[model samples]
Target: MSRIGKKPVPLPAGVTATISGQSIEVKGPKGTLSFKATDDVTLTQEEGAVAVQPRGTSKRARQQWGMSRSMVENLVTGVTQGFKKELDITGVGYRATMQGNVLKLALGYSHDVNYEPPAGVKITTPSARNDVIVVEGIDPQQVGQVAAEIREWRGPEPYKGKGIRYRGEFIFRKEGKKK
Candidate 1:
């Protein structure tokens, strides 16, 4: 038996959840999210809570049951409170600014990089901090995907660390050779 899989996920008020065959959809106060259930897993809802169960007591079923339940849980939370990812610019001259829906990145390059924020994702630069970027959205995967794409524009360099990186992320520096 999977402990996490057996645990019930509480549904909040004004949230609607539906299970049809191998698909589960959760509509919450923030938004709606859906995911496909695993082959060896089944989901049951009762008393405003959802639980996952495996079809058999096999190793694979047990493992997949927990994973499926976690995915469902993430969907619920994503539609409710939503998700956000923060990135920081590390170089001295590197800075980010928003021109309408496009993000202009000046990363010491000859030409500036422009990234258009996708629909449903919000990018905010609250403070004057040169390195701060906040991205928020109801879909966890979309938020993360956009953040990753933005970071890829100028990934942190191992030498001068002149690039975009997630907030609080540690960068490992290599020591120079002895003379």
Candidate 2:
């Protein structure tokens, strides 16, 4: 049996969940989010909680059971608290600034990189720190994807560690060649 699937997702106050067929929709103060489960799993709404169970004893069904449960949980959390990701720029001339909804980045490139966030996501460069970038959205996947895309533009190098990276990420240092 799947331990995570067995536990029902509790609905917090001011949050409501509706399950129809194989899909579940959750609405909260922040926003509304929906998730569709595979046919191998069954979704149900109980008293102040949601539950997931496999349709059969097959391995795929069991896997879907746990996955569906987690998806439902994420939906609840997304609508209630939303998600956020922070990136740090490291270099002598690297910096980030927000112009309206667009993000302007200077990573020692010949031209500034202009990034426009998608409809549901928001990108900002805090005035206190121009080297820090903040990504926020109701969907955890979108927030993480945007942060990853920003990091991909200038990944940290092993020698100088100059690039964009997650705020708490660690970069392994490498020694320089002998003179």
Candidate 3:
């Protein structure tokens, strides 16, 4: 039995969910999101919560049951509180700024790097620190993807500990060469 799959996703106040075939749609103040579960699981709404159950006692069915439940839970949370990721830029002259819908970055490169966020996601640089970037969206995956893509441009290096990293991320420092 799947422990997580057994727990129903409680429908919080101001949040609504609908089930159509294998698809579940959740709407809340933040936004509306939908998820389509595999055929091995069944989806339903009871009282003020969403539930997922497997069709049979097979391995795949059990797997889908847990996964489907998690997806539904994520949808609920996403539509309610949304998702956000913060990145900090380190190193001399490393900064990030928003121009319209694009992000302009200066990571010590000869030329500036420009990035355009995909639909439904917003990127911003707070007033206090241009090097601190915040990515917000209703979808957690998209927010994380955007943050990762930005970090890929200038990953933190152990030697100088300079580059883009998560706000609270800790970079391991290695001993430098001592002649």
lDDT of all the models against the reference?
0.87, 0.92, 0.95
Which pairs, if any, clash in model 3?
A: none
How much is 116 displaced in model 1, in angstroms? 1.3
**Count of clashes, each model:** 0, 0, 0
Location of the lowest summed lDDT over 10 successive residues in candidate 1: 124-133
Model 1: residues with Cα > 4 Å off, grouped in runs: none
Q: Against the true structure, whose TM-score is highest?
A: 2
lDDT (tens digit, per residue) of candidate 3 on 1-179 = 99999999999999999999999999999899999999999999999999999999999999999999999999999999999999999998899999999999999999999999999999999956688999999998999999999999999999999999998999999989999
Q: How should the candidates be ordered by TM-score, best one leading?
A: 2, 3, 1
What value of lDDT does candidate 3 attain over all alpha carbons? 0.95
Residue-level lDDT tens digits of model 1 in 1-179: 77888888888888878999889999988878899987899888889988888999889999989998898889889878999999988888888888888888898889999989888899987759657889999888899999999999889878777788998899887766789
* lDDT, model 2: 0.92
Query: How many residue pairs in model 3 have overlapping backbones?
Result: 0
RMSD of each: 1.5, 0.9, 1.1
Candidate 2 TM-score over all chains jointly: 0.97
Off by over 4 Å in 3: none
Model 2 clash pairs? Answer: none
